[model samples]
Every structure is written in structure tokens, then in C-alpha cells.
Target: MINLRQAVFYEYVDDGVVEIFDRYKWGLRRLGVNFSQDLLETIVYCPHNLENTFMAFCSWVLWLKSKGEKTNPEILSETLMQALKSDRGWIPYDYQKDFLAQHLDILESPQLSLWKAAGQQLGERLRNRIISDISEEGKINFHPNSILTDEEKEKIEAFKVYIDQLYL
Candidate 1:
């Protein structure tokens, strides 16, 4: 089981030479948000591969609920899909359509409330994670070759704004 990440970057410092870097892992770390450990382990071991879809759906559910909106399957699905299309330049989209369909089914199932509760917990973690990441920006390591360009920095800031809107 992979433990939850606690830092924005994974670094190996060998006499000031940097090696072994992964931007994908860095992005996941920066997001620093995920389902509970049990749920994450279950998703990883599940017969099907729908982890991203399930996460997006659950997070959207949590977002809507946090905004005090009563959400249904249709609303949850549509809202998530729209966010994916509109604000997902930074998010990966390699999951199959069946993955999303599975989440839609879960949304309509008797387990919806349970998942929402999990999502609520995740949202709280995400909120705190975002705050800490921003506050402790100076502590985050950057690879020598991985410095952000102006445009990349802008995009990251844009993503921060978008995520802030979602969770705020």
C-alpha cells in the first residue's frame, strides 16, 4: 500500500546533484489530497481501474455538499464532467468511460451517503493541504532542470485559483 504523500516534491540530494524525479508524482503530492487510506487501498486492489473517476466524482460530491447544495446523480455527474472539461488542464484524463459509468452507478446506489462522508473528510484534508502548501512554499524543493517558466507558473496559479473556487 502506498502511504499518503506529505510533501510537494520527492527529492534526492547527492552533493547538490539532483536525480530521480517525477513530475506526475510531484503533481500528486502538490494536490496532496486523496480518499482515505482504506478506500485508496481498496481502489488500487479493486478488479476494475476507476480510481481517478471515483475520486473526481467523490470530490465533486463533497464540493457541492460543502456549498450546501442537495446533489443527485445527474447533478453530481454533470458537475464533475464539466469541471473535467473546463478546469482539467492540470488533471490527467486516461480513465476509460466505463470508469466514470461505474462511479455514476455508485452515485445512485445506497452507498452514496457513505462515499459523501468519505469525500467530506478528503475535502477537509485538501483544504488544509492547500493552505500548508501555499504557506510553506519556500520549503518545497524544485529540481534544477524543473524550474517553472512564466507560463507554467501562471497555469499553476490558475489551477490554485480554480481549486480554491471548488473548495472555498
Candidate 2:
């Protein structure tokens, strides 16, 4: 099994974010003088907010403008699609879509209570795993792999006798 910490923190390191940035740079290069350092940095460090999304879209437009390419929504859409497709594994599209859809208008709705309740339930589940608090029923659930074979049980019995003899 993969170490949970390593899996969770994979995106924060140089090997992860740097590699994705390098690929985006390459795609921009193909379009000529394609990306700016500021733009790259903003994309790397910006929070996933509407303002930052708009900034990223503007950066793409600027890059296209520099290349004498048409600056339109289609161009921005194509660039974003390319960026997403090239880094699908690192960037989970489905989760992003769902989170954005759910939270984008959360401040405007009375359904915030429902969202809070759901979040609380998820928090409790995570807490249970961290504390390793198993119920009485859980203790009754024996792992088959941990069971001793007949031969192993006999050896254990012999070892018990050997210890008993030392006391005698």
C-alpha cells in the first residue's frame, strides 16, 4: 500500500508542480513567446478563486496576442483544455468540477446548512480513522492471514513447554 502522507503531499513538491509547469511552458513555446514568468508564477501559486481564474485566462490571452494569434474565448478554452489534458493525473477534473459547482454559489443560498452538515459528517469519519477507535464488534473481526496454521500452533505449544521447563 502507498504511504498516505506521500500520496497526499505529492503535489506540493518541485517534482510535481515544476513538471506540470514545464509541460505548459512547452505547449506555449510551440505558439511562440508563449508564456511569461509572472503568468507562470501566478498559475502556480494562486488560490482557486474566480479572480485567479480570470487572471489565468488573461495570461493566456496575452500569450496568444504576442504570437499574433486571435485572442478569443475559444483560444482561452483551447489552452485550458490542453493544460488540463496534459496533466490529467495530477489535476482531478471531476473533483474540481464538483467542488466549484457546489461552492461557487454557496454564499448566496440557504442550503449552506446542508453543506455544513455534510462537511461535519466527513470530518467525523476522518477523525475515526486517525484515532483507530474500533468498536467491540470490530475486535471480533479476525483477519484470516493472522491465524496460525496447525503446524505453527504445535510449535507455539512446544515453545510454551520449553519456557515452562526452564522455570521447573
Candidate 3:
């Protein structure tokens, strides 16, 4: 099982998932807006890249720190929607570089390498576990029409819950 209390960027990202939902919930509640858990989950895990995820997370941290002073639903939705947009020609920028450096410039410094390494390890673990659980009895055989059984799906969902806990 993954440890949520670990002082690692990946762990922080996991916590960010939880924090984002909490912030969204509070923001919507304050705005008197109705929302569903599925929508929250979609946005929470919607970012397709590490940079976007970090950006969304940074926004979450900022919003959380703001307390109830600035809980505009329109602004909240816009910020989160921007985070989910595809990065076209925008040059990648690590805004959280100061908080958890990921710049892999060997000539510059290596302190941020720890975050990079931890991210890689955590990502691999998540990928491997998902693949293993989705396979049939540890076998990788699958046809184009592969469809998970109800029991298999349930188990996969359970595994996801376990993985989600790693974020908190």
C-alpha cells in the first residue's frame, strides 16, 4: 500500500486530488451551486499532463488558503477548466518548482531530482497495479473485445479506492 504521509511530490499530488475536491465542494456550497461527485472526480483527475496537474493543484492550494473570502463559482470553474485545457504551443513551466523542484537540468542542480524520481516510481507502481488487476489471473492475454466482468470491475474499483487513499 502507498503511504499518504510520505514527504514526496507524488504523495502531495495525491493529497491535492483530495484537497481539490474539498475546495470545489466548499466553493460550490458557498456559491449555492449544485454539483455531482462524478463531475468533481472528472475535473480532479482530468489533467492529462504533469504540468497541468501541478498547475491545477497549485490553484487548489491557493483557493484553500483563501478560506471563504473568494469563492466565486464562475472564477473557480474557469480556473479549473483552464487547467484541463490541452497545452498547445505553451512552453512548459514548473510554477511549483520552488515548492517541489522538477527541473532536471544536470548542469544547474540536482535537488529537484528527488521529486522526479519519486513521481516516476509512483507512476510505475500505479500503472503496474492497474494492469495486473485488470488482467485475468495474472495473465496479460486480452482480445480486442475484452470486457471486464462485474466482479473484476468491482475489484478494480476497490483497488482504486485503496490507491485513492494514498493521496490522502
Candidate 4:
């Protein structure tokens, strides 16, 4: 799992130095971005009103993809929120609060806002999704497969399949 990484590290440090500290584990490839398909699959399936929240988010993706331009985090976030609110006349304040809280903190670097960057965040968010930690959150970081009705599950599965094809 770590041959390349080890070689790189040892190239700088001698064998004796490494023996002095054997507990450390070197992992190659820092955690920076996520895969496009993972985020698409998660976004459509992660609860928060399929018609309103899900469709609005999808529209944001489609819109960004069409533009094919780079954007900083601030503009991207504002544009996405504006699009969502404009589509429904009004977006719930609770959802907005939760969305920012859940997604913004980890964006230490400037966000790309393109479909790929937006999609990349989905995996980290899903893996980090915790019921106890985000009870008050109204949107983002949600997956409730066991709690869904059969019809709801079908809708989520179908949407995930559709988006998966598009991303590929």
C-alpha cells in the first residue's frame, strides 16, 4: 500500500533515521478531491426533499457544467444558493444554514464550483455523515435508506442510476 510513498520518504531520510521512529505510517496521495460520480450519486439520494432540494441542486450542477468557467468559493456558493431560492421563490432558512455549516468548513482552500469539485465533496460528506452530530441540520450529509418507504427508495435508486450514467 505504501511502496511509492516509502521510497519518496526514504530518499530524503536515511534507513537509520526511519528505524528510530517505526510507528509512523506514510500514505501517498493526500485527501484533496472526490470522484464526480460519488458526489452525484450522494446528492440525489441524500434526503432533503427530492423535488425541491434535489432538483435545485441538480440544476446548479447543470448550470455550472454549461458555463465551463472557474469560480471561487464565495461566488459559487452564492450563485448556487441564489439559483435554488429563485427556482422555488423561497428556500427554507433552516436548509440554508445547514448547507453552509456542513459544506463550508472543510473548504479551507478556494472551491472550484465546477461539477467535479461539487461532486468530489459528496464522498467526504457521506463518510462523515453522523446522525447525532447533525440532528439540527435540514440538508446536506444525509442518508436514510432504512427509514425510507419503498417508493422513496425507488425514486432515489432511479435518480442515482440516471446521474451515474451522465457522469460516466
Candidate 5:
């Protein structure tokens, strides 16, 4: 069986996954083989099996790290969607979607701040929906299909302006 802890750690790296690579690099290195190059290549080329390939790569890296092998830290996934996006060069679309759906909430939360932050980073459209969702008492929802109404859009714009003024 694959080691989940290690897999998760590697997933973090593979996705560029976050800003914690340096913090976790040493731990990953302690696991095993230098699959950084291979893993990175796979991620860039094999879009179809991105999740599985990533999971397997993470598992192997973790296993190797635990064994005191010389593994390079190179796994990363920016977001669930980015990880699951279909790549014409590899695997398949359905597989990526399925994998993303399976682990949709690895680091997500229902907090409005978190959603708002994500929305801000993602763009105004996303931020608007996030605000609307929060206003509607649907903060627990994380699906991409979630949307905001026209009123919510105005609210988001107003909020953005308010925030910008603070910076200015």
C-alpha cells in the first residue's frame, strides 16, 4: 500500500503545489530515489493520468525518503483543478477529472476569508462568486460550478474597491 503521508507531501511539491517545498524538501529527500526529473517530466507530459501518476510518484518518493534513499524534491500541484486539467499529450480528460473529484478538498475550508483569498487570486469572477456564496450561507460549498448573482457581483466589486483604497 502507498504511504498517504508521503503521497500528500509529494503532492504538495508536485503541484508547486504550495509554498512549503523548502520546508518539506528535506523530509522528501530522506525518502529515496531522485525522481525529480522524471516526475516533473511526467507531470508536464502526462496530463491524462496526472493524478494517478502524481500519486504513484509521490508514494515512491516518500517510500524512498523513508528508506534513506537519495530522492530529489520535485513534485507539485498548484490547485485541484490545475492538477486535474486535461493535457493533450498524456493520459485522458476523464481520468484527470475523476482524480480531482476524489481529492477535491485536501486543503480547502469553508471560511469566507479563505474563499475570498482564493477568489482574489483566481480573478474577480471567482471572488464575486465566493462572496455571494458566503452571503447566501453556502460557505461550505466548494464546487467550481457555484455562482454568484448580479447583486453579489456588485458587492464583490465594492469590496475590491474598499480593499484597494486601503492599500492606496
Candidate 6:
């Protein structure tokens, strides 16, 4: 079993590789070996190069596996979404969008409670951003705006679809 508590990233950077603490590296290495076989296709099709960020994501997959969840693209995408959420106050770096935890505990576990919190936070953040954008636009003209661009229309439709999937 992988030990989440021992997943540590060192400050020293060597050739852009994140150096895991000596003791923790063993567990991570074992996790990596197991992950490489099952998630090889995921890594191949991923847009970004698999680095420490990918490993961090694998940790969540490992956790989900421990809970009997199967490894699949949808599960991986959902886990990535939860990891990248801005509302996870425990993450120190604002730009860090991975599931690499500074410290692991029951509260930090990627379980039902954490997923719910992340989803709520995401909704709140989007609502606030929309309100802020409207406020910055100044006076409300209350006029019918120009026809939506194809991209804009697609985005709106996509958001609606996302909302529907949120409950599924």
C-alpha cells in the first residue's frame, strides 16, 4: 500500500526533477511502477508532459483505488478537477494545481467530504468572478447585446452540460 503521509517534495531542484525525500521515494516508486502499467494510455494522451504534476494526480487515483473505484478516464478527469480547484485552502502555492499535499490527514483525504467542498468552492468562485466582471463593466444598459459569437455560444452550452453532469 502507498503511504500518503510520506509523499514529500524536496526544495532542491535538479534538472527540473522534483526530488522526493529519500524514505518516501520508495513508496512513490512502487506506486509509480503500479501506475505505469494501468495508466500508460492516460499519460500518452495527456496534453501536458507528465512530471511531478502527473505523479501527484496518480496519488489520488491510488486513493480512489483503495476505496474500490476503477481506473478510467472519467474518474481521472474528475480527480484532476478536484485537485486543481482553487478553493482547497490547504494548498500553499496559488499557482500549484496538483494533488500534492504538504501533509496528509483524514481531512485532506480525497473522499466524499473533500469532493463536496471542492465542488461548492468552484461554484462560488465562478459566481464571484461573473459578478466582478459585470461590476467592472460599469452601468447596466439593459439592452439586448450583440449576437453571441460561436465560441461564446459554445461556452455557454458547455457550462449547461457541465451543470447537468455535476449531478450524474
TM-score per candidate: 0.23, 0.23, 0.26, 0.20, 0.23, 0.22
* 67-116 per-residue lDDT for model 2 (tens digits): 68864444554565444334221233454445434433322222233233
lDDT of every predicted structure (CA atoms): 0.36, 0.39, 0.40, 0.34, 0.42, 0.38
Candidate that scores best on lDDT: 5
- Candidate with better TM-score, 1 vs 4: 1
Top-scoring candidate (TM-score): 3
What is the lDDT ranking, best to worst?
5, 3, 2, 6, 1, 4
Clashing pairs in 2: none
- What stretches of model 6 exceed 4 Å from their correct place? 1-14, 18-25, 32-52, 70-168
Count clashing pairs, candidate 3: 0
The C-alpha local distance difference test score for the whole of candidate 3 amounts to 0.40
Tens digit per residue, CA lDDT, model 6, 67-151: 7875665555545444434243122233233233532322222233223333464454433333222211122121245455586
Number of backbone collisions per candidate, in order? 0, 0, 0, 0, 21, 0
Please estimate how well model 4 matches the true structure, expressed as its whole-model Cα lDDT. 0.34
RMSD of every candidate to native, in Å, equals 17.4, 20.4, 16.6, 19.1, 16.0, 17.6
Number of clashing residue pairs, candidate 5: 21
Candidate 6, residue 84: the lDDT equals 36
TM-score of 3: 0.26
- lDDT by residue (74-141, candidate 5, tens digit) is 33332222444545322334644454445433223324344656465546666554543442222333
lDDT of 3 at 79: 51
Please write out the lDDT profile of model 1 over residues 1-168, one tens digit for every residue: 122232212342222111111211222222333434333333233332233444544544444555788755444434433433443311324443344344343333222332343235335443233332221222222233545558655654565465455444
